[model samples]
Target: MRRHQLAIVVKEKEYTRRIADYIRGSSFGDRWQVSAFTHPDACKQFVKQGYGIDLIAAETDLLRELQPELSHIPAIALVARLGEADGQFELLQFQALPLLLQGITDQFEGLCRKPVKGLAPNTNGKGALVLTVHSASGGVGKTTLALHLAGVASARGLRMLYLNLEKWNTSGLWLQPGGDAGWEGEGLSELLYAIKSGSSSHTSWLAQHRKFHPQLKCDYLYGFRNQEDRATLLPADAAGMVDSIVKSGCYDGVIVDMDDGMDELHYELLMRADRNLWIVSEERSALAKQSQMLHYGRQKYGETFGRIAACSEVVLSGINSELGNPLPAVEAALAPIALPLVREWRRGELHPVWSSSLYRAAVDRLCAYLLGESEESRIHAVG
Candidate 1:
């Protein structure tokens, strides 16, 4: 067993007392060194001294007021409630999980196991796969598919980065660990600017300055949580920026989500992608939108535009199509566009069922697509 030192910072004394008492009684406290902090400045100073605090726990409000820069320390926020958050602190809300210390313990375990160095190549890492999920229509489950694919790829030991390109992002809201949520104030907008005008150091900066997960093998760089943050990426030179980022070799796969329609930025990301997935409902308009999106991609990137797959085209509620019937129409519309249907993302939460082999098989297929492996390769056991 490895020993880790942690810094627990909180504004409310009562909450801190409960958490610390639980820590002292738990088996984890016996294995790791622990310290506590009541002031944000104190924790900031400790981080500045290069003494790495393996984990940080604090309240959502405290984190928002003082967004300190401790690049390596993965911070967790203890929240009393859950809802929409506003401002730069939105990133911090992810850090705000439920007040349960057990979830905190689980998070701690995962952080310790994460790879602390640069990513190494695997089947999924050999060549970068940029899969962007977007719908011209909302409630189409684009983010759900993106998260499931990322999780499946990661569980199979691939190095992946999921980037939310939409300026007004909501993926972070659902993906928060232990119900903790918060924005880290960086995204494609920052990375794009840094890559073009900034020095080579920017690449290393993005890599080393990421939050880690103990349960999965993926690192996420989140987008703006509000419309304002999305505005920061405005007036971008999409083609030049995409080309530079794609060639940088900083990540093995870059999954992005841009708004629907044939905007400059949307086409820019689609053309650069090695695998582009367009998600839509089975409704007439959704099917039409899928057609338009595919045609738009071909127009922008030419005939060899990355592989295309239509997800949730017919499964969504309110569509008149019978179950599994829309697959034919979807395939038909995509034929002329040159994008083919690879798989369907079944609706609802994507957690794998332990008893069902069919669900497991679907996950394996997703992993195959993500790893770029042939049909013959065996699926790696999920850790």
Candidate 2:
């Protein structure tokens, strides 16, 4: 099936270009085909020529003029502000491009009531369980924990995928060996483009592009090769990419190594995750930072913070007998699971820890907490 087509009729070329770019980078781009026109007459002519346009967005005056001709199609009127008396037209602020695009898609979907074509059907009926490992402070062994979790799950015969969403791609340093042949094809950027373009064969592209981390014992997707690539991605784009990967049914679970931040992208992924782990060190400064982050989240996100807080488990990494218990305030705010520090980890050697008794025990306990079963019992069942 073909995607729904959208027409943008605005007098400003800059607005048209910006809107086009936004749509191309968003999930809407995958679900809908878009064309921009600087004049309403051009849009009207295109429609009159029997081109299929499921939705139209134009400036207030132009939309009022095009309404009589394109009345059957849903239309959104772009406005500078919300003081318009015309309740018949959907009014959207031009400054809020993301919101405006989302509103347009929602209006079109509601009015058309038609399913989009060329999208892969959910044949598996069940998606991968998403688990995000995050920290408010960096260098707290968050990525190490995430890798160990994926490795353990894979060792238990579960298909797993690890996604490193940090600003820089550093998993290669630990997971890939020195003599191994490095990645050859496109990385995450290409896959995101294929998804945004609504390609039906995106699963094939993902399979071709995914890198295998032999030590981690799972398939992994590297982060953007360039810092500029990170800047161009929006929360919605990440959401779309994750959704497509999960829907592919190529893995039983996905472990995300999230960057240390409270940005929209991080929040979106955290909210969508089936389980979330917040890793923090035993240091006073780390706990203080975590507390401040929690406060900021509550003040900014309000009710959304409640949902995030409910699903999250705080893990205290780098804990030793010498450190004793955490501060009363920290304990009250977060009852963290204690994780012992592995000596080899500090030396930048992780493969040996997979078999080390102490390291395995800690990870097994953490896994049991996440999977809601005794480590032995779960491993036996899975194996």
lDDT of 1: 0.51
Show the lowest summed lDDT stretch of 10 residues, model 2.
114-123
lDDT of 1 by residue, 279-355 (tens): 55556777777667666666766654433332212223222323543533553223111112223434544433222
Model 2, span 1-383: residue lDDT tens: 56878888888888888877888888777877888888778888898898988888778888888878788887766666443425434445445776566556544543444322211222234566678888889999787788788888777766678887777657766666562223344777777776677665444445445667676578887566556766777888787777767765456678888889797988888887777888888788888888888888888899988888887778888887676765445522353346787666677554442545676568767776555565457551110
- Off-target runs (Cα >4 Å) in candidate 1 are 1-127, 178-182, 185-189, 225-229, 232-250, 295-322, 331-363, 367-376, 379-383
TM for every model, in the order presented, reads: 0.51, 0.62
Model 1 scores worst on lDDT over the 10 consecutive residues at 84-93
Looking at model 1, residue 227 earns an lDDT score of: 51
lDDT of each: 0.51, 0.69
